[model samples]
Target: MSRGAGTAVGVLLILTGLVWAGQGLGLIGGSFMTGQTRWLVIGLAVASVGAALLAFVRRRGG
Candidate 1:
């Protein structure tokens, strides 16, 4: 994918991960993931990957 598209996807993933984590922790509520530790962990991992991808791309002059 193009650099811009990749960046957009990375941002989206990060935002989604934050939301998922919130929902999982019952902070956002209104979903099956509420109070689910597994989802919370998954969200954090996804957010970390997204952040790392963004950093790597930026360092490479994407």
Candidate 2:
């Protein structure tokens, strides 16, 4: 993907992960994932991947 597209996807992933994490932690409610440990773990993993993608893009001068 293009640098711009990658950046956008990374940011979106980070935001989505944060929301999922919040839901998992019961900080943002009304979802089936609320208070779910599995969701929390998944969210953290996704956020980490997003962060890694952002870092890689930046490092590559993209």
Candidate 3:
């Protein structure tokens, strides 16, 4: 994907992951994910991937 597209997707992934993590951790309750450690771990992994994508794009100078 183009740099701009990649960046946008990466940011979106990060935001979504944060929300999921919050929900999973009961920090932002009101859903089935609340207090779910599994979701929290999954969200963290997704966020890390997003971060890695951003870093890769930047490193590639694209």
TM-score computed on alpha carbons, candidate 1: 0.90
Q: Candidate 1: misplaced stretches above 4 Å? A: none
The C-alpha lDDT values of all candidates are: 0.85, 0.87, 0.89
Task: Return the TM-score for each candidate structure.
Answer: 0.90, 0.93, 0.93
Candidate 2 lDDT by residue in tens digits, 6-46? 89888988888998888888898998999997888888888
- TM-score, candidate 3, is 0.93
- Among residues 3 or more apart in sequence or in different chains, the pairs in candidate 3 whose N, CA or C atoms overlap within 3 Å are none
Q: How many residue pairs clash in each candidate?
A: 0, 0, 0
RMSD in order of candidates: 1.0, 0.8, 0.7
| lDDT tens per residue, model 3, 1-62 | 88998898889889989988998899998899999998899889889889998998788877
Colliding pairs, model 1:
none
lDDT ranking, best first: 3, 2, 1
**Candidate 3 structure lDDT:** 0.89
